[model samples]
Target: MSDEFTDFHLEAGHAANGPYALDVDPQRAGWGYSSLRILDLPPGGHHSFATGDSEWIVLPLSGGCTVVAGTGTGTDTDGTFELTGRESVFSGVTDFAYVPRDTQVRIASGAGGRFALTGARCERRLPARYGPASAVPVELRGTGNCSRQVNNFGAAGTFACDRLIAVEVLTPGGNWSSYPPHKHDECRPGQESELEEIYYYEIAAAHGKEGVGYQRVTPSGHGRGTDVLAEVRSGDAVLIPDGWHGPSIATPGHAMYYLNVMAGPGETREWLICDHPDHGWIRDTWPDQPVDPRLPLYEAPAGDAR
Candidate 1:
């Protein structure tokens, strides 16, 4: 692929720091508001981080953890939270903990695990909170081979954040999601909302081999050019600063999962999008077809692996 594709696609090592398999801050990503980082911890491993001016949620990708947060640099602990995580992204939904801005957070887990720090630069300093997996809304969208499951754990309607919106999408093997090629890079009343997005991938391995999938993003021709059609795997990521993104495809036998973190400078926090006119009609056909039977892959109560 050309730079148009490569520019948006980030290989595993291209974005890493310590235990973070993927780290994209507003500055590093050349955008504002949205940012994401996935941390991998070994058994009994502990890592401390500072949430300078960003409000964040510690969502688990695997395993459990204990989070201790404090306001001051010294030892005046402000709050502590326990997160009962899941076995993997393919597992059921997991509980999460939110950390306020300008705070220090220390995370320690009894067993190894991976955590997604979904965040957004914000002016508000809301109180730290916790969200249970049971409370997360799981939605099934599209139909047939286009069917997908969405865990709106940190979505605008699900979680109360100053500006952030995060969600996890699971597309069963051979299915497609993020369909109809939608764009949210323009703020059109009753039409669309402007938002920068980050797509972090985790594809399930097949037959003892590394899994593989595909992602697509085309420029909306609004002066913010971005074009990409990249092959992705576990730990890979795609950035959508401005463009129409969709059709995250899962190959046969290799289910796909992506964590979407989005935010922008909009006055309100919402996820409104406009589908490509050519493919917009796909939405109309969904009503006639049955949803893929392989849905609700796993219930929220898979006996928390943590």
Candidate 2:
């Protein structure tokens, strides 16, 4: 399946006055048929909803929020998990998913907080988190940029989870990250493989200016030179149903971050990519290289970039 890309502009406080507007559907974006939204809640207000699809996930990018998630099969409602704020989440620093055919859920913000939501359909439900026994954390560090961590979830779990696998990549500087293009659209026999994917981005800028960045994804193979370039900022998203994606280029002015959620029909969810033969080896050469010194991970109190 090939992916599609579309740009959206969401006003910070323009939510409809009803329960909740279906908002923006990313599935319609020509990717894996998913939906995403950045929801704003009034202080002490509550938003409770269910997904029409078999799976869904709710993530908090800023502020605090309380969530109640259950098996959806139980009647008593107490058989649920309660998560408060980003620090208390079981998955990504500010993200988590709710799976299975139908799961009833509710979320509320205490004072100020917004959520970056991403969901996709799947044959089965993948566990919320993986590893802990003896999982090693790999950190990618750069200047002005702090370190980003990757917990080999699928690797440490020994592939016990479902088809939907994930990894956590954090960025601290307004730096160009996720560089060195890679792809996984085709499955190789035993050694290399591919999987269609969608990237859900989350970012936070300083007090004034809005955070800004760009992403590039291109197809691999001879004569397949199509490419996609998207300028994505907070609440903006891009999809990669099939192609090599990289260099989530962040403006060298503010600190930003994003989470890459991916899954496919393939048996394994490992992060495997067939590089552009032209630059595939760059990944092997970055061990001794230094991150670009011009990148700015933290944003100035000034307004967002135009």
Candidate 3:
């Protein structure tokens, strides 16, 4: 890969700094809004930080944690939220906590776990709140080999945020997700929205063996025209500045999971994308095909659809 592509793909441990196993901010990513950090805490460990000018979601990758939000002055408190996280990314839908900008937050893990701090630079300081696991909208999308399950926990309209739009996707082994290349690099009113994105991946293991997946991002005639084709593994991440990214393919025996963190300069916090014209027609065929049986690896609470 060329320097541009390599710059966009971060291998496991390559982006680690201090307590974060992985960290990417707007300055580091060459963008203005999106950022992500993975915090790996040992059993009974705790960490604290200020939110700065970004709104953040404390989403667990495994285990559970208690999030306490407060003002740094020691006289005011936002609130405390207990997250009963799952065992792993493939286990089930996990709960998350939202901490607004300009506040101090602390996370404590009793049994230890990997947690994702999905963030976005924003203008408003929303109230701190808890998001229950049962409130997530589990959406089964695509069909057949393109099938995937989406946990829209922080997606726009689901959970309120100023600019952060985050979601988790699970693709069965041998299948693909984020297919039929799409781009949100242009602000076309109702047609599309300009946004920078981050894809954080985790591939499930089998028989004590590791797994892998692929990610591709092509030029979309916007900005610097980001291009990337990466062989990704657990803890790896891909940044999308301006490109038509798609076909995140999982190898035959390994289930793939990815957390998408998106934010941009647009006024509205929405996730509207324009599909690559050549492959846009694929959506039309999904109506006639049967969704893969392995979809929705786990179900959310009944009637809790968002």
Task: Give the Cα lDDT of each candidate.
Answer: 0.88, 0.50, 0.92
lDDT of 3: 0.92
Backbone clashes for every candidate come to 0, 13, 0
> Once all C-alphas are superposed, what RMSD does model 1 give against the true structure?
3.4
Rank the models by lDDT, top first.
Answer: 3, 1, 2
**Error at 77, model 1, angstroms:** 10
- The residue-level lDDT of candidate 3 at 125 comes to 83
TM-score of each: 0.93, 0.68, 0.95
lDDT of 2 at 98: 40
| Strongest candidate by TM-score | 3
lDDT tens per residue, model 1, 1-306: 221233679987778866788888888777778889989999999899999999899998999999888854444326788998889999788999988888989999999799999999999888787788888888999999999999999998778889989999999999989999999998887779999999999999989998889999998986358888999989999999988898899999999999999999888899999999889988999989999999989766534333
- Candidate 3 segments whose C-alpha is farther than 4 A from its true place: 1-6, 72-77, 302-306
Residue pairs in candidate 1 whose N, alpha carbon or C atoms collide under 3 angstroms: none
Q: 135-235 in candidate 3: lDDT tens per residue? A: 89999999989999999999999999999999999999999889899999999999999999999999999989999999999999998788899999999
Give the winner by lDDT.
Answer: 3
